[model samples]
Target chain A: MSVDVLINEVGPRDGLQSQGKTLTVGQRAELIGALVDAGISAIEAGSFVSPKAVPQMAGTNELYALLPAAEHVAYSALVPNMRGYDLAVAAGARTVNVVLSATETMNQKNIRMSLEQTTSVCAEIMQRCRQDGINGQAYVAVAFSCPFEGETSQSVVRSLSDRMMEAGAGKVIIADTIGAANPRQVTGLMHDLVGSISAERLSCHFHDTRGMALANVLAALNEGVREFDSSIGGLGGCPFSPGASGNLATEDLALMLESMGMDIGFAAQRLVPVVRTAERLTGITLGGHSFRWLARQVESEEQGGGA
Target chain B: MSVDVLINEVGPRDGLQSQGKTLTVGQRAELIGALVDAGISAIEAGSFVSPKAVPQMAGTNELYALLPAAEHVAYSALVPNMRGYDLAVAAGARTVNVVLSATETMNQKNIRMSLEQTTSVCAEIMQRCRQDGINGQAYVAVAFSCPFEGETSQSVVRSLSDRMMEAGAGKVIIADTIGAANPRQVTGLMHDLVGSISAERLSCHFHDTRGMALANVLAALNEGVREFDSSIGGLGGCPFSPGASGNLATEDLALMLESMGMDIGFAAQRLVPVVRTAERLTGITLGGHSFRWLARQVESEEQGGGA
Candidate 1:
């Protein structure tokens, strides 16, 4: 197993943020701790945002305070603006992820800002991260294709990624916010991204809305992306984006990665119990077909070839 | 738009094969006709296998005979044996597909044969296909991972693919039979494939079980594979493979391809109606997330507001 890949778990932040029943600060911390125990190195802990805008991520600062401090285990907080960044830093988040869309339509819909304005704000946050000795990851949301906008151009996506890189971002996450991208688009954009930025400095975030997130990731991976963002048990969706399914499931992605002999330092089978817990807590279906099948498989295995 | 993509619609053969309700010969022809009307040039019409094993694909010769002999349509059948190939030839099949597993366990369970025996049979069939002026395509099942035996090696996958290419096969389809592959695996395999064979000769068949089918396709597309197998409304799963979901949806793949500005000659909006028809016919949910989302989007557009 090649220990070259970074599996950035996003279930705590992206997954829980979608559930209507928000986990308390302690629960969030526990979840993060569980992820750490499961051998995940990087984790998106929570987003520093207004409770009014995103109630689920309200107590992220408190949750971050409870987390065990470790050098190898990097906990990241999502921030949209300077205020969010300041809150993230105050909460002891050494890694901060700032997100903006590549298209104007998504920028307006997601954050109520223009692309230029979002880029400027992200740049400011990047500068802050650099000064504070924190790692900054810029999430290029809707980098593939936007729900509001029909298709995002490769040139626009590349420009946003380049700006984020220029702004001192440690890594740029090319996100398929709506899961509307095909392999060609993923490869094309990643090609443009790698041309300006190093492949090691790129990450991928994908939604399984149209069930192409992993495929998009593969396309990007072919272009040399090593880091990926995935939710545990597929417990995520954009609350703002009504029809989205979820982020690529962390366990499932890890399973695929490990099965391919890529060292992601995680076991998918070990995470099943956590998935069940999340499902019980949320009362929402996690992965539609795969999870149920996995449950039956384990049950059948335990039954020992029962009729 | 690059007009180079060849979408081999497997809805009739693969999609219906896994469904509960078996369409009659006429109904199957009508469905294939609808796909032809939608401008899909290549199609896997049916599989010539044992009636008991795959009742839905029974009497494939009858269905093949019933299909419209359009000049543009490249009607084909999945041949399991020399007898099946003879039946397909008698039915005027211009193209034939043969399946082989990269893993020994899968080949043993699926075809009850060793990998060597399966490869040898496929080779013989390919030779026969050449003599009969048929374009023979070999599908490397479990190319990424096997259900019974997990984590298929790249060497095993590549050797099988190489054998298929040497067997006078016109095209080779690398299938993630159990949907146990990630983007990294997909790209890594495609990288190997592209180096050894022409991209034009390679195709991909993916299942959406773990929701990486499209991502795998994207990676394959990045490596220059233009041909792909997709089921209409994402209908079809390997009955032998436990917990497997259907093939990558034709409409969804079309959507992503078109969104990327590559011309596969599929209209997602037009395909929605056919998908609905398929759901009605099969009494199985197909494209539940995407179809519902697309319908609402269209309805909202028609109403001049959010639906």
Candidate 2:
């Protein structure tokens, strides 16, 4: 099937990292199974972070080993530093991701490092991944706004994104860590980024905290971005980031894309059951804004109600 | 105050008409007062229809008479026919609107009239508004997709809109009656509509049932639409129209526009209390997707926590 956009499901990593309940490796594997069944090919499976720091991501390595080994399925995990990158590589990970905060205060608060130090460490990880023949990706976190520092400098985000790309990162995901992005901001930043680094290597991660995620996605898509990061059922946000309410739900993104006559490689309505499964496993009442209308679509179809 | 967009509030009419509980004319006046206080300049006060058929709008004439007589606040009303139009003008209405369903099935089902009959009636009303020197507007209902007839013909919408304009309608509001519009469709149709009719005489009314309302708004905004119809707190949809769900909330639209540095003539945060008043009046939980984040901004500001 032809795919117009590549959606990297991040429920297993970014979504779970901020969750209250820690799913066991087995439970995490179950979630992945449901996502694959719904026609997801690329996913952020887990992270190589410390179990003590993020209990929700504790069993990432074991979860990776248990994930489906389908040739088309691309599973990636987050690595904060060299040790984490080594653990990820030892666990048979083919793709490794590193987070590079764009602001000085965000770096200090998140990883107790200066912006310069975090950027260097991330660049090193990306370089290592390239040497080891791994698909290296970097996230420019808080690319839009910092809760403590107000609006981030556009030039700063631009410089760091260029640095990550220079360090052999195959892709740079611009992440709105605090969900403070609006469409105009997304369009302006995406326009500059796509022009400089090119759109083929760029993706966006937006939060629906202010109900502009889908709009942000549209702006980026218009600017030629072909990939995005979404969570199943709008699962989670960074625990350390205030007001980063919900990740853009996979169902919402998929439905909007498909409804626009764009192919996403699956029937968007089929994800109704997958959202239910996510809710059951995590014990969290979850779904995107479009979940109810999507569920009704499945119901109407089952009862033979014609469009 | 400078205004980049003209928001015609429909809560007093469309918002209350479908409610489970009917508000007295006095209470509806109170809701309008709240909207006006929040910097709303244009409002759809109510409809001059058969009282028994729509009891919620029974006391519209009385309500209009009681409303504030501020020169800056432009209020409008809906009129179904010549008799309704006369009633509206007699009630001191300076602006009047009429609904012209785009699909045959919708016309038959909603008003027991053929599409041609409804169009003629609406055209006559617009013509009359011209002779009377009143501001006339026509709504092309279900302009994107109709529930009973599936996709509405774009050519039919274009021709009818032109007819209404020729007959003296000052503006044509392209309404997504069932909340089924996508950004792709919106962009394509709006491009043609704006090109043919020019952007100055057009507006859009979107519903949030499928979570693409804001996206649609952005698409239309890019096409040069400077007017929109919104309901306070996402108050109501057509009771007769299935799947219409929630009207685009005024607060959500205002916030997104303001965040993008566009002037919407009011502080978006000030709508928090307005939404609360709506909830209190209707006895329903209401707010757009941005409501939570908007509330938090207000809270943070009150606590002197600088953004």
Supply the TM-score for candidate 1: 0.84
Docking tier of model 2: it is medium
Q: Top TM-score: which candidate number?
A: 2
lDDT of 1 by residue, B188-240 (tens): 89889989988988999888776556666776777788988888887887453
Q: Which digits, one per residue and each the tens of the lDDT, describe model 2 over residues A1-50?
A: 15899889999888877778889899999999999988899999999989
Fraction of true interface contacts that also occur in model 2: 0.62
How far in Å is the alpha carbon of A147 misplaced in model 2?
A: 0.9
- Superposed on all Cα atoms, the candidates' RMSDs to the truth, in angstroms, are 4.3, 2.3
State how far residue B106 of model 1 sits from its true place (Å).
5.1
Per-residue CA lDDT of model 1 for A249-268, tens digit only, reads 77767766665567777655
Q: What residue runs in model 1 are displaced by over 4 Å at the alpha carbon? A: A1-3, A68-71, A80-82, A101-120, A144-168, A238-244, A288-307, B1-3, B100-128, B140-169, B180-202, B238-244, B288-307
Candidate 1 chain B, poorest ten consecutive residues by summed lDDT: B237-246
Candidate number of the best DockQ: 2
Q: Candidate 1, residue A138: CA error in Å? A: 3.5
Q: Against the true structure, what is model 2's DockQ?
A: 0.55
